[model samples]
Structure formats: C-alpha cells, structure tokens
Target: MNTHFSLFRLPETFELDNQILEQRYRTLAAQFHPDKFAAASGFEQKQAVMMTATLNEAHRVLRDVIERAAYLLKLNNIDADSPEHTHFEPEFLMQQMAWRETLMDAKLENNAAALTELAQTINQAQTELHRNLQVAFSENHLEKAAELVRQGRFLQKLQQEIHAV
Candidate 1:
C-alpha cells in the first residue's frame, strides 16, 4: 500500500466487511466534521475543514463499489492508470461507439424517446460494469477492472450528456 491510503487514513486492510468500514467511516466523519470545530481556533477550524473534505472523499470512494475496487487495485500495485494493462474487448468498444452514435443522432433529431432509450442503455451498462468491477477486484484481475473503469467513465459521460439535453 502506498501513501495514498495514508493520505486519507483509510483502512488498508482489504477487508470488504461492511460493518467495519461503516464504523471507521463514522468515526472519521465525526472526528473531522467541521461542525465539531465550531468553537475551535481559526487554524483549527481550517484544519478541520480540510480533514473533513478528505474524510468525505474517502467515504464517497469507499461507499461506491466501483471506486472501492479501483482503490483496492491501486493498493495492490496494479497499473490501473494505463489502458495498456488490459486489451478492452473490441466488441464491447464497438458497442459503446454505437451507443455514442445513437446519443448523437438523438441530440441532432431532438428525439426525447431516443434520449430516454440511450439513458436506459447507459444505466444498464453501468450496472453490468459495476458487477464486473466487483468480480475483477475480488479475483485480483486489475487489468480487467481498469478496463471496466474506463467503460464506466464513458457511460457516466454519456449519462451526463443525456441529462444536458
């Protein structure tokens, strides 16, 4: 484990046990929450805010299955930063391109139904990607997990585009 986990003081124990995580999260939140420093010195309050922000970020990452898996992979010395680690299945990439085309077509035609369909498709992909992420993480398949993260990023981007319409 690198200093990244230490930066947030997040547990480095690969324990996915939710009970332990929840307790740790709550303890950190309580300790760093800005409200708890309402009467502290200015510097203390600033430090509390910074700590709280870090704690909140950690909570967000830990609470999300995909993010948690990605973090764990990083801890395991996996080169998740590069797509070179895994060859993304070409068929899936082509499918994603088709979906992107659909979204573009929908936007150009101002078709509400098409936008809705695209949203549904992206949402389904997100679900599948999350499931894959869990499996990849549990099996220590870092390359596969990284590919899923990339796919998830595109799906999320598409989701935002749909909403912007």
Candidate 2:
C-alpha cells in the first residue's frame, strides 16, 4: 500500500491538521496535474495522469477520519476491510438494532424533529467513538481500534439513513 501519510508529508495518526493537509494537497495537485504536462511526451503525460490520480486518492483517504484509521490498521497488517474482521459486541449490535427501529419509526411518523434528534445522538456517539479510537491507536490496541472503527462505520451509515429520510 502506498503510504498516504508519506505522500502528504503528514504523520500517521488519526488526529491531523486539516489546514496543512489541504495546503499539501493543493501543492501536490498543481505539481502532478496532467494539464501541466499536456505538451510533454505521451509517456510523460500518462505518468503525470497516474501521479495525479494517486495524489487525489491519497488526499481523500487521509482527509477522512474513518478511512485514515482503516488505512493505519491496514499498515499494521490488520484486514479492516474484511467482513470477518468486524465483530461488534452483542450490546453494540442490540443498540444498533434499536437505533434502526427508532429511525424506521421516525420515518413512518414523518417526524422531522425526531430524526434531527436521532442524528444529534448518533453524531455524539460517533464523536465519542473517535476519541476512543485515538486512544486505541496510541496504545497499540489494534483489536480495540478495529472495534471502534466498526462502530464508527455503523454510526456513519445511520447518519446517512437519517439524511435520506
């Protein structure tokens, strides 16, 4: 895997400075943009295109908290993307189901206030999970980090569902 942190000259951590990331992205983008090599040889242009694509992908993965965490896990030989790697605790699973039911109920009743409140609640949970994830990473607790990532993914999906409704 290409190290996105290396590409952006950033540290390999969930906590990042968005301002510095944006600046690095823009600098690399301008340097690797295909248009800059439009008059160059065909091979040079193709290389530029590939580099530009890589830069964009690296920037995207590093900018998002979830993706960045997953990438870090991957670097540590953890298969975070695999289904078998995700094993949420029973309590968390039950809570997820209850949240889903609440979402469904709010939708059926056309309750905008309820949906808004649910979104807020989920967002708070997501924030807390992120904090836990940071500690997990710092402590070298890959299993705990992976579990937090799974919960974070659930909350993210729930947030999207709330938005769709």
Candidate 3:
C-alpha cells in the first residue's frame, strides 16, 4: 500500500535510471499481464492482475515529466509542493494565460487560423520546456525542472480543454 517511490524498487537486473525503468516495466508486464495468466489458478491470476496494475501505475508516474520532477524533488528532500514558486517566471505565466485566453476566444469564433497558430505556439513552447526540463534534471536543478513541469502540465491540460471544446 505504500505509494512512496522508494518502495518501488527495481528487479536486481534493473536500475533506477530511465532506460532500466522502462525495461523493468516491460519485463513485469510480460509476466503479469492478464492475458499471460489466463490459464493460471484463481489465486495466481489475481496476483498477476494486481501486479500488472501496480506495474502500469509505477511506469506512468515514473515516466511522466511532471510526476518525475516531483518524485526527484522528493528524493532530494525539497519542498516540491510549492507550485506557486518552484520554477516558472512571471512573464512566462502571463504569456501562457494570454495564449489560453486567445485559444478560448478563438474556439468560440471557430477561427481556424487562430487555432492553427495557437497549436503551433503551444507545440513550440512544449519543445523548449522539454529541453529546459532535461537540462535541469541532468544538472540536479530539481527546483527549476519542477517549474517547467508545472508549466507543461498546465499547458497540457489547457490543450485538452481546448480540444474538447
């Protein structure tokens, strides 16, 4: 029942780095996927099902940019929960808000050109932010990376909302 990342240890053959994490995910999934246990006894099948779910959840949280940032902060004993001031500049937030508002208004007006531009802008921002995140993580700047992740998560949500509209 422990949700702590430390409790999610890799197999001895695996490691905590990104590549090993993915490898472990695949290995566990191959063994624990429901399809792989279909002919097992009821108890064995249930265990496989639970293991599969846990493996998927672990992979999801570990692989995601935002979640990985938060996890890294926790590992370093930083207060990553301070979303208000972790990594983003005010100007960046302001620009994001303006873009979101534009997207909202454009959706209402059914402006194809506006939508296209907005999409491109968002994509470009994402690319830059991803690079920033990589640099921050590599340099052990969890605070900075956390900020980029926060912005990315917000932009992703905004993109989904716009698409839904």
Candidate 4:
C-alpha cells in the first residue's frame, strides 16, 4: 500500500501542516473527481472513483493526530491499537484509572464545570503526548512513539466521554 504521506508528497513525520494537507487534498480530489472522467472509458471512471476514495481516506488519516500516529506505527510494523494486547506502562495505566475516577466523580456530582475542566486538562495532556511523539519519531524511537500513540488514544477517548457528559 502507498503511504499516506507519499500521497500528499509529505515527509513521514508526526507534525504536519494541516492547512496545506487540506489544500492539497482538495486539489487531488478535484483532479481525480469521477465527474472529470465521466466521458472516459469505464475503466478510467472506475480508476477515478478508486483514487478519490483513497484520497479521502488518506486525508482523514493524516488530519487526525491519533490516526496519523497509528499509521506511522503501522509503517514501522508496530501494533498500538489493541488495548487488550498492547500493554501501557504501569504508571500510565494507574493514571488512566485515576482519570476515569475523576471523570466518574464529576458525572456523579452532575458537575458540567468539572467535566469541562477535566476535558481541558486531558486536551493539554494530549498536546504533550503529541509533542513527545514527535521527539520519539525524530529520534527513531518507534517503540516510544507507539507507546505515546496508545496514551494519546486513551486520552482522546476519555475526552470524548467527558464531552458526552
């Protein structure tokens, strides 16, 4: 499979300029739009459809940090997505429990304000994870990057729960 970064002519890195990715995605989408190939042979139209879908998927993966991190891990032959199989550090695991307790407590108390504040704190933690992932990737520390990717995933899910509350 062609890498997502190569589709957008980007380097495989944790940090990307999302604005530029969106612009390039638009250009690629327009170029491969099925309408543009409507008058062409059936094969050509099919090709256009496939290309458009690929571009859409690539854009979706590249624009999100968590997805991008997973993609990077995949490229390195690492699996970070399966919570049941891939174990996180004990400290992080303990912290995850604490975060969940805090979130549950806020919900039990019916404190939207506390939930919102907790969400903000989780967002900050996610930002830090992203930053650390960049350093890990830059140093070719794929294992560390994969661990951070898992942490980010947990934080993202926790934040979603907070918002749901």
Q: Give me the candidate number with maximum TM-score.
A: 2
- What tens digits encode model 1's per-residue C-alpha lDDT throughout 43-122? 99999998878777877777665566667777767656565755567987898789889988999999999999889988
Which is the winner by lDDT between candidate 1 and candidate 3? Answer: 1
Is 1 or 4 the stronger prediction by TM-score?
4
Model 4, 99-150: lDDT tens digits are: 8999999999998888888988898899889889889988989888888888
Clashing pairs in 3: none
Residue-level lDDT of model 3, residues 64-142, one tens digit each, is: 7667666666656765566565556889879978998898899889998888888878878887877787788777777
| Candidate 3: C-alpha lDDT | 0.72
Q: List the residue pairs that clash in candidate 2.
A: none
Predictions in order: lDDT? 0.75, 0.89, 0.72, 0.89
Worst 10 residues of 2 by lDDT: 79-88
Q: Which scores greater on TM-score, model 3 or model 4?
A: 4
Count of clashing pairs, candidate 2: 0
Tens digit per residue, CA lDDT, model 2, 1-165:
449998888888878999999999999999988999999999999999999999999988888788889989988888676879667789999999999999999999999999999999999998898899889998999988887877888899999999998
Point out where model 2 deviates above 4 Å: none
Q: Each prediction's TM-score against the native?
A: 0.77, 0.94, 0.74, 0.90
